[model samples]
Structure formats: C-alpha cells, structure tokens
Target: MSTTTPDRSYEALSYEWGQPPNGDFQIHLNNGHSVDITENLAAALRDLRHQDPSLAPRPLWADGICINQKDMEERQDQVAMMSDIYRQATRVITYMGTESDNSTGAIAAMELYCEWWNNNGASSRVEMGSFTHEETIAIQKLLSRGWKLLLMCGRRTLAHWSLLSDFVVHIFDGDLKEGGFLLLPQSSHGTDTRAECIYQLALLRHKVQGRTISEECKLSWLLCDFQVFAATQISDKVYSLMSVATDVNIPIDYARSARSVYLDAAKKILANADDFTILHHSFPSQGQYLPSWVPDWSKWHYGTEFVVRCGHLCPSGSTRPSVRVGELENKIDLKGLLVGTVTFLGTPINDHYQRSSNAGERAQWVQQELESIKAHLNGTDPSLLMAECLVGADVFLDVRQRSTIGEGFVAHMKQPEAIIDDVERSLVNSFVTAVRRRSRYSRLAVISGDYVANVPRGTMKGDWVGMMNGGKHLYVLRKTSTEGEFTYVGISYVSGLMQGEILASDSPSEGRWLTLV
Candidate 1:
C-alpha cells in the first residue's frame, strides 16, 4: 500500500456499481493480488485510462477498488473521508455505466442545446417547438439519460455531470414567456411538463451555490432528496451521503444493522434540525423492525412532493420541538397537540390515475374522489378546501394562480363540460400538475371538525392527526396497544389546521407528551 500527500493529484470516480458481468472481471495489482470488480467499475476504469494519451497511469480513487469493504472499521473511516476526497480531487469523473439507452445521442443533444442557449442570450422565448424533429428526439433521449442518472445517484452527485447538470438547471431557471415548455417526450396525457424533477435539481444547485444555507437545513434537504436513490446495502443510503451532508455525524459502521443505522441517523437529524422537516420524510415501513417515526430510506415513498417547507404553513406555529429519547430502544416522546382523528379516507389516487393518458378519465377520477370526500362532509361544499388540499395549500403556485385554479376547480365541479375551453384547459393543466405534486402515494381524508387532509396512503379512518411542535406539516399517528402511546402513520396536509389555526387557540403549554414506537 502507498500513502499519498494532500497535494497529490488524483481523479475521483463517481459511478453506479451495476450488476456483475458474465465473466469474472478482475484486475491485478503490482503485488500480484487479483481483485474482482463490478462491470460498471471496470468500464469506468478503462474509460479513465484512455481518456488522455499523455495522462497514462493517472492516479484514481474509486470506492469499490480502494476502500476495504470487507473490513467494517476501514469502511467507516474511508466513508467518513469521502467528502474531502471528492472535493480535493483534480476533477470528479462521473461514469454512468457503458453508454446504452442512446446516451451518445443524449450527449450530442445536450451540446446542441448548450450551443443554442449560448447563442440565444438564454432567452425564455426559446421554446421546445423551435427544435427540429431530430433534435427533439435527441433531447428526449438526453432527458431519459438525466432521469436514469438522477434515480441512480440523486441530486448531490448530479453536479459532477457538469454538462447535463448545467443545461437542466439553465432550462429550469429560465423565465419562459408564458408557461414553461416541456423538455421531455409528450405523455399520452398531453405534454405534461416534467419540470418538478428539473426544478428540484435547479433548486439544489442554487442553494449549494448561494452558500447561505444552514448546515442543519442542508443535511435535512439532502436526506430527503437522497431517499429515491438505490443502494446495494440499505446502510449505504445514510453512509453514502455522509460526504455531502456536513451536519449529520452518524458513524458509517456496516457492522450495525440497517435499522440501527437508520434510527441513529434519524435521531441525529431530529436533534439538529431547525424544524420537524425530517419527520416529513418518515413513512410507514413495510418492515416491523423500523420505528414508525424513522424513515426507511430503502423503500420508496411518493408523497415527498409536498415535504418542502414554504414558510407559510406552520401548524405548530413558533413552538420549538420538545423531544425526549425514550428509555427503550426504538421509542421517542414528542410534545404536541392532537388536531383531530381521521374520520373518512377517500379512494387513493393511485399511480395509474396520475400517469393516465386520457385527460378526461384522469379529471373524472380526481373529481369523483373529491366528490366522495365532499359527500362525507354532509353535503358541505368543500370546493376551496379540496383545492387547497389537492395542491398542498398553494405552496407551489403563486397567490393569483392559486385563486384562479381554485375558482377553476369550483367551475369544473359545477360544469365539467366547460373545461374544453382554452382558459379552462390551462386551468385543468395547472390542476393536474397540482394533484401530481401532492396526491401521488396519498389519499384524501376527512378528519374531525369536517377538515379535509391530503394524507399518506396507509392512513386509516381512526388515525390521529397531530402537529409536532415546530413542525410545518401535521402528522398522522395510529393508536398503539399501550395506553397513551401511538405509532406514526405519516405526515399529512390538513386544510384548516395548516395555517396555525390550532396554535392560535391552544398554547404550546397545553400540548401533551406522546410516546412513538
């Protein structure tokens, strides 16, 4: 083994370890020791070796090859140092496996787009229709590449793919003349602008570049964003992010169980976060081992579209969290007031409805769901309430848009035929986007006091809805067998209680401690 100085120049590799190839892909060291590596790593090594003729024998740092994965202590130490390793490297070479899925075309298309963008003064006037058919096809391929890479690595590592990252952010940040244009292929439901994912990437880049974000907020956001990424070992979900997240300090010990690592990470985040934003990421875990309060990063959850705090909806309202660690493992006590119990659950807005090509069918499904929720409220017209709940209380849209959309929703409910007009069409599009943002992996619920909520799918009729002190979103808690104890169902978006209405009447002192397991 050789030791290198801090000033030494080396290239750090960021890649997905795809499935192993058919043959045993092995490399021999100078000491004559053969080490097996994944097919993706082997491809990356070959690409790095021949990228430049004169840069032969370039010093490289690849996690699979350099880190002693078999040794728990060494793995932990190496992982802790990964952040500095990537930051100090001459450049980060991100290899997204061998170029399949028309990746070459995607790269070419990106170059073309960048060239066009630079020539056009980065104007919002440049629409997707301006591109030729061939160019559009290439752009679609490029977007597919972006989504694949994003799902594989998450946003933090996307910055390494400089060209694609910059291009996507530029498009996302551009102020279009009208509504934004679609960059990806047109969905059967018409051209739905898949800008949400791009917007997230752009937002992350902006925050990181601004350097004004707190370490706590940064770590919390990073953890939320990283939940979608896949990893061979579930613990790596937390450990892999150790390099990018400056605030989190959980030990990267593979010797620990996945649940243990997840629990420790959750505890650390909750303790340090400025608000209860981390709780928004928690969902019902399929496994019994993980506590309901802790997030299971291994399993994918869909309601994250509404997780971002917008500084408006403060259910807990200026109260700091009163959290105490329980004497028993996998248990915590939090002080908060119960908003109400869920009295009715509307049909879940499944993925099919969200991805449906028939706009009429999708709209009808949403309308029926809303009508069902309204029926439960004793024929009380919940037009605005339903609108607010569906779109997450205007968190994503501006005040004017929210008003217009809310009015459109009322009109749509009154006369479904009028939606064919241009204005109404635009309204339907906005409504669809809003529903997609909040409703995926969730269902509409009617709580006590006739309040409506956008709750996680698993929320039952009897689940208790409460707001943790300093939390932006209300949480759904299920009663446990033990008295005065509950298990977390998930976060919820309640219409009336979202704006601190409960806090206005009930003081923080009135809140009681509820144990969560």
Candidate 2:
C-alpha cells in the first residue's frame, strides 16, 4: 500500500485535474473504503482499467489518491518526492482526457500525419487530399486547438520526462521523434505542461530548439520551461518541482512564503551558473506579489517575445559572462553600466488578450504599432527607429549577424553624427521582408526618444535599456526610485541598435549605473 518503498515497481500518472462535475467521484481504497477524486482523475482511472484488462488492479500512483490532501506535512513530503516517484516507476502514464466529440478521428489523423512526416519531411501545408473526410475533420479539430501554433513556437519540456521516462502508449504512433512525443488528454494540466506536448507532438512538424545544448541545472530549466503551470498552494509551485531538480537541498518549508522560496532558489541557481540566463527567462510575476527579480512561474507568457538562446547576450568570444551574486543573500549586483532616463514611451503592442494567431493579423498589428511609435517620435528623423524595427528580434539570420558583433561598430560610436548607410538599408529591407513574410511571432517593439526596438512582451516605455559589459543583449532596467537602485527587466534583443548611443562610446557623462538589487 505504501508507494514510497523506493524499490516498488508501479505506474505514475501525470494528468490535469479538470473541474469537478455535479456529483462526487470516488476512488476505492485498500481498506474497503472509497475517497472522492476529481472527475478528470476518475475518467483517467476508468480508461486505465480498460486499457490493460490483463493487469487487473495494477499498482499505480496518482497524486490525488496517494497524498493526503488535508495534511500539510504529508503533502509537502510527497510533492517533494514526485520526481523520484515518476522516475522510479516502471512507466509514467500521461493521461490525456478521453476522446471527445471528434477526438478519436482527430487522433487517428494525427497518427497518419505523423507517419507521413516521419517518412517524408517537414511541410507547412498538410496534404488534405491524402486523408479521408473524417481525417480532414480530425485535422481541422486538432488545428482548431492551436496545434499549429505549438508547432511553430519555441518551447521547453520537463527534462526528466524528455530524457528519463519511457512512455507506454503511442497516441500519435509513428517513428521516434527527436526528443519524443507525449500525448496528453486535454485538461487544465495542459495549460501548464502543454508545452511538453510540443516536445512530444510538435517534434513531427518543426525541429525542436535546444535539443543539442546541455542544460546546467534542472531547476533553472523548470523555471524557464514550465513558468505557465499553476499550483493550488503557492508554495507547491516550488515544492512540486523538487523531483526533477538537480539541487534539492533548497528549503521546502510549506510555512515559508512562495516569494522566499523563489528568492532562495534563484540565489542557489545563480551560484551554480554565473551567466544571467535565468534573469532573461524570468517573466513578470502574476499576482504572487514576489520581487521583480524572482520569476513568477505562475505567469504563462514570458517577459519578451524573443527566445533567450543559451550563451546568448554575452559579449563576443566570451564563454562565461561577467556576473556576481551577493555574499550571503539573494541580492545580485551587476557591474557598473550606463542608464538612460525615459524620454518617451509607446503603447503596448501585445497585451494578454490582443495577441493575433494569424500571421497577417499580427503584421497588421505590427504596422499599427509602428504607426503609434511614429506618432510619439514627433519631428525626429524616423530612419533610425524604422531601422531598429526592421532589425527586430527573432529575425533569424539578421539576429545571428547582429548579435555576433565583437569589436563594436565605428558607425555606432559616432551615432547621430554618422550612420551606416548600407546596414541601415539592409535592416530596412529586412523589416519590409518581415512584413511581407507575415510571420510576426517574435517581432515586438517599444519606443523611447525617437528610437524603436524589439522588446519582450512586458517591456514599457519608461524602462531603461542599457548594456552590461559582457551581456550580449541589452539589459532592460527598472528604476526603484525610493531605494535609489534598479531591478532587471528581461534582456532586450533590440536589433540594429546593439551598438548605438544607448550602449556605445562609453560616455561616462551620459550614463550612470545604480546598484541592482
């Protein structure tokens, strides 16, 4: 009956608990008693029971059943042991909810599509003629679920699930994908771990990013990848992640505030890795009221639109970035850098709701957003701002070249007085091509003092964008007026302006660095 024997062979279920139905849903216990569970978990058990009839009443571990929900101490202990629980299991069964209206057909179509993709290669347009009427409908159903968006976007998966576990069922049965496919039933859990499906399902469509790079720590990866998942208890957000985390020594006290746990985790992660990778991955906290420096994993969207590539934003040819942490505390101090006052700020381009799925719609939004930036620039020459917009973040080839500049640019040192005509035109052409291409996933802009550049989602007009000596991307700084210090906004991938007046010339008179806390 004890699931924590450490040597027991059992199946661990990974599923989202959907909203409960009108009546009680109960699970039978060993003592000839039954306990209530979410309707979603009950549904999963029924399917599991039917799935392997041969193994009648197979030994399994379901969080809702195994952990005593009412006992805080037991819940914390079990939650901390989840990673080991999953890893030790003979199999980790992901319960995607049962088939809905057209789910069976949708799943079959997806399987066939996977087979075709495995045999052939990546193609944007699906060969609808190759499928039957039902298959077409299935594909449409899947597409309607934004499966297409999952294919195109950058995502991260649970490292343990991606690398350690072996899945039992092949929902999208086909050749092995790059990482592997994890077909989950539709549930609220999908909201947090849905990106995990991108690894399992979307691998068939596009080449998954970061498949090659070695992850430094599991906690960092979890914070970066699984920021969107929510937990009932705020502290569970940190506690539940203990299993897969390489550093488990961090305190897991349920009594402590989530902010304290997060701050402690950040401090530990920074100690292991000197680079500022975690800072960039952090998004603004969602209602948790944590410090700006602590990443609120509760939020779904990242701070910026651009994917913070590994070893990115560090100065050229440098493997290790210049970073230092507090001696015995959570505070981090960035070496002295420049600061600029907010002269002008633009309206938000992408808010929580207004994000457009269609490329054309996003381009239209970008155009309108640029027009708004133009209004704020007043009478200044629009060329520089336009060039920055053109060289927007995630522009692939352009970003690669712009991010690799080592010796700095002569034209940038003489900005306002001198401009690189050829580079400016190239950026202009890039911007025009982006608009025409109509692929507006990561291109975002914020305006300040006759300047516009690609910024993350939450970037505001008054935020200070400055250069750190070894940082590859511009560090967005927020002023703490009362404390007379600054906090990090996510790193900015402002194209073309990488070496401009904001970061260039080392003008001691023009820039000042306040202690970052």
Candidate 3:
C-alpha cells in the first residue's frame, strides 16, 4: 500500500499460513490503534524486524497481511498483481518456519551437497557410497521433505532424487545389500501449498541461474504446477496463477464460476499456443461439473508422467498441424482424423499397486496384459501391427535403450517366460518410459486393422483412437449415444500411428475424419 522508491526494496514471503496456530498478535497502526494479525505472520514480521540493525525496517509483502481477505475486489486485484509483485521484489523468501529435528541436519546436508556439486561438477547420479553415514541420513531426510518431494514429482526419471525419499523411508524394511528398494508411504506434509512453493521458488531459481524461459512456456508450467498448489477458494487457483501466466491472459472476475475461469484460461492458452498439447494434460476433475479437458488444479491426479512426443506424425512444419480445435455453441468443436478403431484391448496394466514392487509379479502382470492384447490380435504379425501403432518406432526404440527401463533390460528379462512376455515388455517399455506412466489403471487399446496404443483406464474395447490435426499424440474418442458425436477420452500413446501409416496405406476407406466435441 506504499509507493516504491529506487533505494527501497521489498521481499515477498511464500510459505504456508498453517492454521495461525499461535493465535493472534496485535500490530500498531498509524492511527495509534492496533489490529490483530495471525501468529504466523506476526512471527515472520518479528523475524524481519530484528534482521539487520544497520538497515531501516525493510518493506515486506506477505499475502496474509497486505491483502484484505474480507474484500473480494481487493483480493482479486492483489492476486492479479502477484506475478508483478514477486518479479519486481528484490528477493522472495520462502519461510518454512523453525526447523524440525531432521530439518536442521537436512539444510546442512543440502549446503554441503551444493558446495560439492559446485566444486566437483554436476552428476546425474549421486554416489551415496562415498558419503559418510551421517551425510547419507541427512541427505535422505532432506529429500523426503515436502518441498524437495514436490520438486521431484512429475519428473521424467524417478531413479535419482525421486527415489531418494523412498530409500530413506524404507531403509530398514528392505535388503539394500542386494539393491532392492521398498515402497514407503507418502508424507502427510506433501500439501498443495508445498508444491506451489517448490514450483514458484524453482522458477525464480531458474532465472537466477541464467536459464532462459520463454513467455509461452511459463503458462504451461503454471497450468501443470498449479494443480498441486493449495487455494481456499476454488476460483483462486486460476486467479492466483493468472499473474505468472504469460500466454494465458485471463481477466480477474470474482463473479465468474471456477469452471468458467478454468475454461477461459484453457481457451486463452490454446489460442496462444496453437497446439492440443495443453488439452493432453487433462485428468479427471473432482468436481463433476468441471470440463474433462480442463484440469481441476485443486486436486491431485496420478499418472501424470510426461508423454513421449515423437516428432514423426506431427513433426514441426509438416504442412498440416496435428491438432485443431474451435468453440461451437456451448461445446468445443474438434476435428481430427480417425487412425483406426480399437478392435482389441489389454487389461489395465496396474504398476502402481501396493504389491507391485516384486519384479516377478510386475513381469507376470505385464505378461498377462500382453497375452490379452496378442490373443485379441489373433495371428496378426507383430511388426506390421507395431508399424501401424507408432509414429517413430525406430526412434522410440533408440530412445528406450537410453531410458531407465532400457538401462535395466537384462535384469527385467532374468526370469521372463513366453515369447509374448518379451514382446509385451518391449512394446510396453518402448512407449511407457516411467513407472508412473505404466499405470495398472490405464489400458492398452489395439486399433482395429491398424496398431496398438495405450489409453487411459476407462477406455472401452470399441473406443476410437484418432490423431487431432496438430495433436502431438494419439487420442481416444468414445462415441456418444447420438450419431456422429464423440467425446474425448484423453490422449493415447498409439505406437505405430506416428510414422505416416495413413500415407503408406493404399485403402483410403480404412480411415475417416470425425468431429469431436
């Protein structure tokens, strides 16, 4: 509420308010009166107030203090200005409050680790054997912290930083002598607010480290990361994110419904990005009224492993874009080419179950899923089928060799059974990169007379798999009761569809263009 000066600087605080546990504290105002503020903010203010005796009282902007929550208009205005407020501020302090028993040790370990990295250079894998027992324990505790776990979430590889927390949690439960790791329950402290802190802090850190972030990409990150950020009001998720979004420029409207705000944000993002990649990021929303394509940012959605976008079918500058979408009436108008119909399907490959840790069990489950798919395929040649299913099979194979699955290929095949097991493993391993992507909840759909692809859990046996004009990946389309109408069932990783199979086939009658809404 004060004017800025060149000599003066403000620091923004990003942390959880945590129920105002210490209750209220009095703050003296200019009118010689006092107002009550939460204990959390009071603590933060006290911390800042006592900070440097040499300097004047530093200006700080904490959301709980600066914005009047009772005033909706003021909240909206303040929320809209958040990006500017943070970006313009000299520093953004993330206050996790007083360190816990493990936290102090974790912080020390992090400082030492960073120092080591600075001197020794960066290595993707940490050589834990080189560290002292105390160092190992400290590192483990740090990795399991909410903020650290948030940073590791949705990562491409769960082998390093992501798995460190699990190792720490289950160190005594498993036989680490044989390189076996056990699953551990996720921390209760992994709140949406913690995720929000990680994302915002990491983003700013990226800039500090001299990484170039384009304007368009920030919106994508904001959209993806916003899903885990805590917000009291459903609409605030969108409103809070608007400031950070570069591509999506949605107006702050307190009158608008959360759905409307979300839909508007999606529209803006699509309009600016001109790709269906945004649409592919969708997961089922908790609110039934929310659009299936528009993600509900307030809730957690599993199986968000990054999709491998092979540049074959929808390669850059391919004359025809892979996806095209427009709004018609009250629904989104989508037009895409139907690659093929799913004549056969595999059982949902559940890799995330509690008992899925056993390698033999994992192999057996995969084998069963593959057998079902192959049985449905009948006598169809696997190569021809794969040719039809993938975009760049050769390229994908090359990429797989370098992936975590590929790195452990020999170990995975140690006790393999029938030929179908290897085939299924290879097929599943090719497109499915991470443990998260290989969900037991998601099934594999075999496009009739074309190729096999992976679809979300709810995909039916007869669901249609198509390629939106500018879409990066194949999409599952379910036919509605009404003729010619189809609903999008989320994006599918159809293996063979990407390598120009449509062009290779002489029979044009095999494929048809359908309008999706």
Candidate 4:
C-alpha cells in the first residue's frame, strides 16, 4: 500500500511495530523486500507530523511522543527498543534540534537519540569520536536496516561531518534539498565546533558526487597542506552548493567562505594519497621483492610487509576526525613469493583408510622434515636472514589460504533451524587458533603458514598490522583483540610441517622438495 503524508507520498506494505526504544522493527514490503527502523530517537514528533494519503494508511511510530516516556512501564518497555524504531521508519525525519534527549549540554544535542549498546559497557552511550568496532558495527547495522535519514537543517546542529555518512539521509535546506551542516563557534557550548561543521559540509559535497575520501575533518591550513589532504569521494552538489549558496531564497555565503579551504584540503589529500609515506622501515631484508623490485631488490622466500597510516590532519579546531584504511594489492609480478593455490581438497586429510603413504608413514616423514628446517634456522648466524625467511613463510601462508579471507558481515544472520553451523565454525576457529599458538616452536611441524591481520576495528585502517612469520606466530607486536584481529592459517605441504595443518591433502608434485616414489 502506498502511504502519503501531507508533504510526501511513500509506498509501504507491511512493517512490524517492535517492543520499543531499541528492538527490531522490520518492514516487509508487498514486493518481498524489507529493512529495519529504529524504535527510539532523541526528539519527539510534536512538530514532526505527516498525513496518510493511502486509503488504508499505516500508522507512524515515534518513540518520544508515541510511547509516553512519562509512563515508567511504557518508558522502560519502549526505551530499550532503538533497533525497532529506526527499522520501522520507512524514512527518518531528523528535526534539527539543539540536543539529544538523553544527554545534557550543547554537544549532546547532535547525538542520534537511542539507548546505546556498549560492547565493553564502558558506558551505555557514547558520542561518535574515533573509529571503534562497536561504532562500525552500529553503523553497519543501521545500513543493513535501511533507514534513509531526512536531515533538517537548523542553525545549531554542530556535529562533525563524518557522522553524516550514516546520520543525514537527505539534507533539507529548510527550503530545498541543499541543506548542510550548521556553523558553530571555535568552541561551542555543546560538543559543537565550526571545524566539524565545515569538515562535514565538505564531505557530503564529495560523497554525493560519487568521489571517495580517505579521511574527514580537516583543519584550515596553507594551500600546500590542503593539496596533500584531499578526500577520496566527490559530491555532485559541490558545484551546486557553491552556485546556489548566495540565492536569496536560500542564502549560504558563509559556506562560500569554506570553499577555498575545502578545495585546498582536497588537493592536499589527493597529493599525499598518490605518494605512499613510509611510517616504519623494515631491514630491506624483511620485505618481499616483487617483479618491479626484482633482480635489483634482492629476493628470498618472503619480504617485509609494509605498514602505512591512512589519515589527514583534522582541519584545525575540529575535535572529532576519522579516516578509512584498507589493504590495496600492489601491481607487481612474482618475486621471492610463490603463488600458493587451494580448492576443496577431496580428501581434506590423508585418511586412516587410503593413506598417501603407509599408516604411520605420514607422521614419521613430517617429523623428520621439521627437524631439518629447525636445524637450518639454528645454523643461521644473523637475525636478518631469520626475519626475511619468517616473512617469506608468512607470504606463503597468505597466498595459500586465500579462501579464509573472510568478509565479516557474511555470517551475521541467524539460521533458525540450523543447529550445527555455529559449532562447526567454532571448531574451525579453534583448530586455526591452535595452529597459530604452536607456530613459534622451532621443533614444531609447520603444516600451514600463518599470519595475523590486525585491523584497528571500526576504521578500515591499515593503521597497525602485526604479521607473524615462521608458520603462525602472533608475534609480540599485538596486544588486544578489540583491535579487530583475525588469525590466518595457510594450508601448505604437510610433509615439511603437518603441525600447521589439522587437515591436508596433496597430489604428488615434483618441485618444492618432496621426492615421492
């Protein structure tokens, strides 16, 4: 059914009313599509009303007014149901208000009102600041639920621009669709600031234009600094926002003042993005020498994996800032690294039945090879060779276990009737974990190559990566799990190190050392 309000006509089929505040209010459309809406918000619908145009119109659910927060039972019931509120609203209308319902003060005004769920329970609510895993999960959950925000442009909305990616659906100029961030003081009463406002306005302009930005919230600086810190995404409306700012119907001249500042920011980001700045250096011996660096850049089995920070300076005075980092494949041919390959091995492990060798033969052969490799490592006089070789081992592991490069959100939903799925995953993770723990032992059989990709959760950042070499060592570099870490186990030849594999299978191949008769 198509529901029309006084201002807009929206088509709706069937949507559920969740428990209240933070429950899941899912909408199942007539066409068999759906999305989630939140059940709680910072503001009520006192002035935010809509008319139903359809013959059979569905009711609008608003938490502040609809649930009667004054009623203890109702407030308790509805307040904790934020998941359902945003899930239920076909489209969210963010009435540009001064502050959030729960928090007091100016900065609190910019909060997306809800009963925030803190993973560590450090606090029930948190203002968006740096990149956090919980924040990433929260935003990703919002995206999965399909909530289009209708941001109302008022004079005091001093929140930063980074939050705009998830908060602002479509901005209203209070007249047109060109509305942007409200300007504030260098130090506004609430958590408000002009730097955040300027930064966000610049970001929305770029994103809507289909351009990508690596970072957000830049402080005003020299032209050269601006050139080196440009954002990645571009907005279609940058030109339009600039052109229409001075129109009497919708005056935004102050925004015009920010143009030179933003352009300079954009230029700077683009320049830096083009050139990779070295954060920490490897001993040169530790890095893998790809084809380009080949013959000239010496090669072994593996090279040092480089680490770089992806960020731009927060335009001066901006209290909040963010950047997204991801691993990009380098364009290079083969080097010290061998391309390890995998397919669903028919015999995942050498069976107790049809053995690749005699019943006890598999165990005996693998143990002997482990001793040989251990001896080689012990003989090495320098740490450089060990580091390089260890790095090489990591390269082998990464290339071999390419299938385990999990896309996180893939397994989020519940499989209602499926009983063994989680158990299976647990078993797999445990096995993988075991291989990782025992990797450091020189005497251990290295069946699979292993490495840990530490993504500083919430930010798709290349911020800190702790790579373990020599078949699955966690290394001393990393400390916490909150940093969004995933351990890897690369399936390799078991004869040399079956300790690395809980499972393995192979066809007789001539090279890389096994001489099978």
In terms of TM-score, the best-performing candidate is: 1
Q: Of the candidates numbered 1 and 3, which has the greater TM-score value?
A: 1
Clashing pairs in 1: none
What TM-score would candidate 1 get against the native? 0.84
Runs of candidate 4 with Cα error greater than 4 angstroms are 1-60, 70-72, 79-86, 94-517
In order, what lDDT does every prediction score? 0.70, 0.52, 0.54, 0.27
TM-score of each: 0.84, 0.66, 0.74, 0.20
Task: Report the Cα lDDT for residue 275, model 3.
Answer: 65
Whichever of 1 and 3 has more lDDT, that candidate is 1
Q: Candidate 3 — what's its lDDT? A: 0.54
Model 2 Cα lDDT, one tens digit per residue, 1-517 = 6766766578887776667434488977678998779987887777766455576668879988888777878877787777778768887776656565465665545555555655675443343355566654543344334332221111122223222111212222223332122233334332213333444343322332444436433676666655545565767666777765765457667888777787788777765654555676665544556556667765555222234552323322232344466673546655545444344444443331121234344445545655666666674444444444433433433545555222121122232334448675344334443332222223345445445565544556577766664455666777776464677666665544454434354542333334566
lDDT of 4 by residue, 74-120 (tens): 54444344434544456544443322322122223224321122123
- Clash-forming residue pairs, model 2: 96-184, 96-185, 97-185, 181-200, 182-200, 304-456, 313-472, 313-473, 314-472
Q: Give a tens-digit lDDT track for model 3, residues 1-517.
A: 4525667678877655666434358678788976567765666566557445998767788888777777889988888888788888986765544444454555445445444644665333344454556655654444445442222121111223323333332232222322222112234322122222333445444453463465344565566654545666878777777766665677888888887877777656655565666566666434626555666666655424233334454521232442235655224555456666778776655442233345567556655655666776785545334322322234334454434333333344344344445565654444443333333246666777746676777788788877655566677888888776777777776664564554454333233445554
Candidate ranking under TM-score, highest first, comes to 1, 3, 2, 4
Task: List runs of model 1 lying over 4 Å from the truth.
Answer: 1-4, 20-23, 51-56, 117-199, 212-218, 243-248, 307-311, 350-357, 362-371, 411-421
Total clashes in model 3, counting residue pairs 3 or more apart in sequence or in different chains: 22
